[model samples]
Target: KVQESARVSGILHDIGKLVLLEFPDFFKKAKLNKQGRITQDSEYAVLGTSHSEIGGYLLGMWGLPNEIVEAITFHHRPSIQISTKPDLLTVLHTANGLANMCLMEMESDFGTYLDMKYLDAIGVSGYLDEWLSITHQVLDNTDNDQVQT
Candidate 1:
């Protein structure tokens, strides 16, 4: 039950990124250079809304569970007062951090910062290796299956 909410939270975590597509200049400015680097300014600054908040707003509009909505909205700042325990938000926080780290290495234009305090608050300090391993395994599984398609 809780895990399901967490999964949903993860899926909806980036819902705000969709809005960035609406502004070509902002979206293009958010892109990384050929070498995959960005300056202090982010594309979101131009769009005027962060992905977390945008995702939360959309989820709320969709009539998702309050917990799910909170998890999606506050995953970036789990310390904020929400109705549920830190579990679902923690999962999302960690997943988002790991995903951001991966994208950073890939030179993705994603400009969000992964808050270390969120990881600590979620008690996920030691699980990074396992999380990354699982992520790679899932990616490999999908890649392998792609050949079949």
Candidate 2:
């Protein structure tokens, strides 16, 4: 059940990226490099709105539950105080971290940087290393499959 909620949270987390459509130059500038690399410098030089915050705003506009909105809003900054402790938010936070790590390894232009306070708030610090390892394994498996195909 929590996983399902988290799935919803993940789906809504990046909804703010849609707002970037308003800034074509910024969007183009933020494109991943040919090698699929993104850096803090590139982001600052490109689109101004980070996807994490945008997603939260989108969720709020859609009238989602406050807990859901908080999850979406604070997934990147989980240290922020929220009215409720939603398990879904924690799940989204962990999943986002894992996904960011995977995307970084894949050389995706999109970068993931979250506050460490989020991990402590979620009570899942020990799982980070494990999740990172699993993310690599998953990437390797996908790469192997692609090579075989």
Candidate 3:
């Protein structure tokens, strides 16, 4: 059940970007003025709320599970979560950050980073190295699995 929740949350986490696309002017301003800053901060500055929050709200309105809603809502800043116990939210947050770290360009200023404090609070900080190793291995396998034209 937990894994399913995480999977669903991951799939839906970026749904708000579609909604935000309706306001191209806001995105243009955010990109121009909010370089080198966290994406959620720029989004909030331009749209009055972050995509995570918007996605969460939409999920909630659609009657999705609260776990999925909260996971998507606070994946960018899990330290702000009310519960310190590791759960679906924690998994989603950590996985999202790690994926971003691996896939994003080095020179990009997207500001994707792990919340170590949150992981420490949940007693999961010790697993980061192992998780990163597994991430890299999975990425390697994925690259090898691709069919070249």
Give the poorly placed runs of model 3, Cα more than 4 Å off. 32-38, 105-112, 143-149
Compose the digit string of candidate 3's lDDT tens values, residues 1-149: 88889779878988888788898787568853223443777887778899899989999999999889999999888888877688998888877776666554332222336887788899987887677667667766776334110
lDDT of 1 by residue, 1-149 (tens): 98888777777787776765676777566656554643223544655556677788888998999878877777666666442334777777767765655544542322244455555555665666677667556655664433210
TM-scores vs. true structure, each candidate: 0.68, 0.65, 0.84
Q: Candidate 3, after superposition: displacement of residue 126 in Å?
A: 1.2
| Count: clashes, candidate 1 | 0
Error of 2 at 125 (Å): 0.8
Candidate 1 error regions (>4 Å): 28-44, 79-85, 102-113, 144-149
Model 2 quality (TM-score)? 0.65
Q: Worst lDDT window (10 residues) for model 3?
A: 103-112
Choose the strongest candidate by lDDT. Answer: 3
Ranked by TM-score, top first: 3, 1, 2
Decreasing lDDT order of the candidates: 3, 1, 2
Candidate 2 overall Cα lDDT vs. reference?
0.62
C-alpha RMSD of each candidate structure in angstroms: 5.3, 5.6, 4.6
Colliding residue pairs in candidate 2: 16-54
Across residues 25-112, which tens digit of lDDT does each residue of candidate 2 receive?
Answer: 7755675765464443465566554666677777788888777888887676676655234376677776676666565554322224
